[model samples]
Every structure is written in C-alpha cells, then in structure tokens.
Target: MNRPVRTGTDPDEARARILEVAEQHFRRIGYHKTPVADIASELGMSPANVYRFFPSRDAINESICGRVLNEVAEIALAIACTNAPAVEKLDQLLTALHQHNKMTLVKEKHMHDLIAAATQENWSIIKAHTERTVTIFEAIIRAGIEAGEFEVEDAAEAARAVRSAFMQFFHPVLIEHCVQHSEDIEADLRDQIRFILKALRKRGSLEHHRQDQDSQPIHG
Candidate 1:
C-alpha cells in the first residue's frame, strides 16, 4: 500500500520524497523494473508531478546512483581531513574503499546491478566520482610531501599513479572478478598497499620501512 502524501512540502522536499520512494522501489524491485509511475503512486502523486521535479526516469536513476557513490567519497574526504599520518591515512582510505565496494557489489548484488547499469550507461556519475577520489588522493599525497614522508615532484600526478596502481583493488567490477576467480585477494591487496607506500615514500622513508620489516622476526 502507498503511503499518504507528505503534506506541506516545498519543491526540494518533493524532489527528495520522490527520490526516497524511488530508491526504495529500486532496491526492492530493481531499477529497470521500477517505473516513474510506480514511484509517483507510492508518493500519492501523478507521474506528471514527479516529472516536474526530475526531467525523466534516467535522471532519477543517475541521482540515486550518484548518491550511493557519494558514500565512499564522503568517507575518503573525512579520512583525508583527519590528523593521521599520510601513509596510515592512505592505507585506511584504500582498505575502506575496497571493503565498501565488496560490501556493495559482492554481498549486495542488487546494488551492484544498479551501479553496473549506471556505469554502462556512461552516466556523469562515474566521472564525478573519479574526480572526487583523485582530489582526496591528491590531498593525502600533498600531506605526505609536507610531512617529509613522500618524495614526488607533482602531487596530482602521483595521486593519479596511486589511483591507477590500486584500481584493481578498488574498482567494483575488478573486485567482483577477484571474488569469482577465487583469487588470493587479501595477500594481493596487502602487496599492492605495500608497493604503493614504498613507491610514494622518500628514499629515507623507504629505507625505514625496509628496516621496520626486517626488524620484525618472521612468524611461521
């Protein structure tokens, strides 16, 4: 049964309501199966009224996907702003990103389908998400440079490199592939993070990392 129209709302609130209901229907029934008319009916409004807020169903899908992708972006931004060391912050950021993708794609295949469709459709969401991620990576790299932890002539370029190097670990489709292939994902992910940190560190910092590794006795 549809809920009563949320009374006394402005345009922004109405749009939000449509999105909220639309997301529910999409999550429950699949994005392609859900119609704007169904979303409108849920909100006790007509499809025409819904179109007044969003131009079309594709617009709504894009908005929903963007909102979902922004969760990772928000987490990365928060980590970038933290008082942690750049290396540690980067590690945490990467781990969080991987886990978030796994949780969404591997564990929650429904959401994965939504994201995959958005990506295949070439929505602006992917470009916007990539820009946000690169910005966060650049912030961390700049911090490492300031802290004398990293040696890089250009933070933006280094950030791009880092993103490229870790793409396999963070990309949703790639992560799904690893799962399906039964790859040694944990060991590979650790190796990737180790390599990224080693590449980003100054000569002295790299030496220190090597020494730290050597100092730890091997465990059988």
Candidate 2:
C-alpha cells in the first residue's frame, strides 16, 4: 500500500520532506508508536537516510517541538513590537498564549505527548523557549516602564513575576489539566490580568483611587 520513494530533490528539500512525513505520523498515531522506519516508508526512503538528516528520533521530535514553540514566540514578538500600550499588549499576549495551548493540548493534542516528553527530559528546546518567552515579557515590561505606564523599578523582575503569576494559564501541563477539569479558566484569567494591571499601574491614575478618597470620611 506504500508508494515508492522518489529521489530528485537536494539535501535541504529531502530533509524537509522527512520532517514533514515524521510530523504526519506523529500527529496520526503518536510519537512513540511512529518509528523512524514508518516515516521513511511514508516518504519512500530508508530509515538510514532519515538518520542522515536527523541523528535520532528524539532529535527529530526536538526539531518539531522547537518549530511549534518558535511559532508562538514569533506571535508574541510581533505583539510586543506593536504600538499598543503595555497593558493591552500583555493581555493580548496572555490570551493568545492560552488560546494556543488550548488548541494544541486540548483540541488537537497532536503534540501533547512530545511536549510532555520534552518537559520530563528537560530538552534544550523547551528551555530556550521558556527563556525566549521571559525575554519577550521583559521587553514589554521595559517599554511600559519607559513610557511611565508602570511603576515597577525593575523591569526584569517584574517580567519574571508576571510569567510566574500567569503560569497556570500559559503552561501547557496546567492548561491541559484545567481544560480536563472544566475549570472557569477564562473568568480566572480575566481576574488575574486585572490584578496584574492594578499592580503595574502607577497609583493615583486609576479612577477608583479618587473615588475611594472622595468616599472616605474627613479626619481631624
């Protein structure tokens, strides 16, 4: 039932074809069930040739995972570079991240096991992705501070805090758990963002500050 492998492309295209077929098998059956031979067979090539491009099955997985995470990074970077205020940008970034995780882990689940393995194995790709995310957060926080929109003295620390605070909404494992448990994720996410904005905003700028002052009784 399998088609014969055709050879005419250069090395670059050949490697790319291997990755494409491997991803197809990964999505169809799963990472573990799909072997290098299956991917090679799908491409009408030998498993040895697949290794010519990738050293091992795990290497192929890491490459694919990196590609997926890189997509999110690119999206976040574009949002961070926008003219929107830091508050609005942060909200969009977090919302986008949650949506991405929901689509990947909850809806499609094509790469869930690979992500889990990356987590347990402490893959370099995962570490790089986390660092890149933190760096993007830092950039947005720095912009807010420079624009006098946030009161934080240390942008890097604030960025780290934001990432840690929103881990529940952004982290893949937590996202999966919350989805499976039917948690009110959106409500909680909104509340958390509100809290983050309140903490970041320069005091006295919020309308409620003046309202509270007007409501207070005169003191002797």
Candidate 3:
C-alpha cells in the first residue's frame, strides 16, 4: 500500500512566521533579551528549525528592522504622490518622518533600540533604507525645480544634503537623545525645515515665502 507523504511548511511562509513571532516577543520581552529559543518555542518549532530559516538572531532582527524602515518609506512615498506643491510635500514628508521615528521611540522602545543598534553597526539594511529615502527626496526636489519652487542645480546632491542636515530628526539614536535631553525637538525640527526651504527656494520668491509665513505650524 502506498503511504501518504507529509508536506512541510513552505520556506517563505515559515520565514515570515518566524519574523512575526520574533517581533511579538521583541515587543513583549526586550529585543536584546528575546532568544531564538523563545521564538521557536512560541511557534511550536525547534531552535534548529528556526535557524534553518534565519542563520542567526541578528539576521532575524535585520528583517524586522527592514520592515519597520519600509513603513517610513511608504509614508514618504504617499506624501510624494500627493498633488500638493513639491515644497509643501517636502515639508510634510520631513515632518511626518520625524514624528514617526519619535513615535516609535515612545511606543516601541525595544524596536527602536534594535534599529538604533543596526544604525550604529552600519547594517546593510540601514544603507538600503537610506538610499530609498534619499531617492524619495530627490524626486520631490526634482519636481520643485521643475515648478520653479527651488533653484537647486542638482536634485540628487540636494537630496543627500537634506538627509544629512536632518539626521538629528531622522536618525533613531539622535532622536532618542533629543527626547531624553528635553531639547525642544519640535522647534528645532521646524527651524531646520525652514532653513532647508530657504536654501532651496529661488532668489526673491516672494510668493513661496509668503505662503510659508502664512501656513500653520506643523504639529507632531
């Protein structure tokens, strides 16, 4: 008699399941304290089996961190696609990104710590995420240039500069430090954005200047 074959879980599904369970544990227990064994046990699998999907705990953390970064990227893309003027879009995008990072630090400290460590370690995922964010900035800058809103000669270079200048607001580690030190982050963020906009605006663009002056201050 022929015997029925036992089917194993799909590799991709298993990997995703492992990430889900690991993230839950990272949230409940701290990221540094959550062991692969705990994740495996919760998933009803052996630690070795989990290892088959992710070579090490750090590898799993990298995947989870990537997902978190991707959410920020999505928010940027959504703002970029809006019909609003490029200048306004850039303002909103930067503010939204900063607020998202701050929210993560307040609500998900463990996940924030994981990403901060990844940033300090110069992880590949961090590099990739930075590139993605810079690309979004470049696109917005290009649109602004086309609309005579910005006088920058090179969108790509300007985008990189913007990213560097806003590091304190965007970087997880720096954001946390600002929060801990009670350094009036919102005021600083607004000042930084205004400075960047001034640098990007065309000479004597009174209309944009007036619009910026009239616009309500960004909150959060």
- Among these predictions, the greatest TM-score belongs to 3
Model 3 TM-score, all chains together: 0.92
Model 2, range 1-220, lDDT digits (tens) per residue? 4554445557777777777777777887888888888888878778887887788888899988887788889889989989998867886788788777777886558787777678778999999998899999889888888887788998889889988888877777777777778567676666676677778878866455435434544221
For residues 66-175, could you state the per-residue lDDT of candidate 3 as single tens digits?
A: 88898999999999999998888998899999999999999988889888999999999999999999999999999999999999999999999999989989899889
**lDDT rank, highest first?**
3, 1, 2
Report, for every candidate in turn, its global Cα lDDT versus the true structure. Answer: 0.81, 0.78, 0.86
Off by over 4 Å in 2: 1-9, 206-220
TM-score winner between 1 and 2, please give it. 1
Total colliding residue pairs, candidate 3: 0
Error of 1 at 203 (Å): 2.2
- Whose lDDT is higher: candidate 1's or candidate 2's? 1
For residue 54, what is the lDDT in candidate 3?
82
Error of 1 at 93 (Å): 0.5
For model 1, the stretches where C-alpha displacement exceeds 4 angstroms are 4-9, 207-220
Cα-based TM-score, every candidate: 0.89, 0.87, 0.92
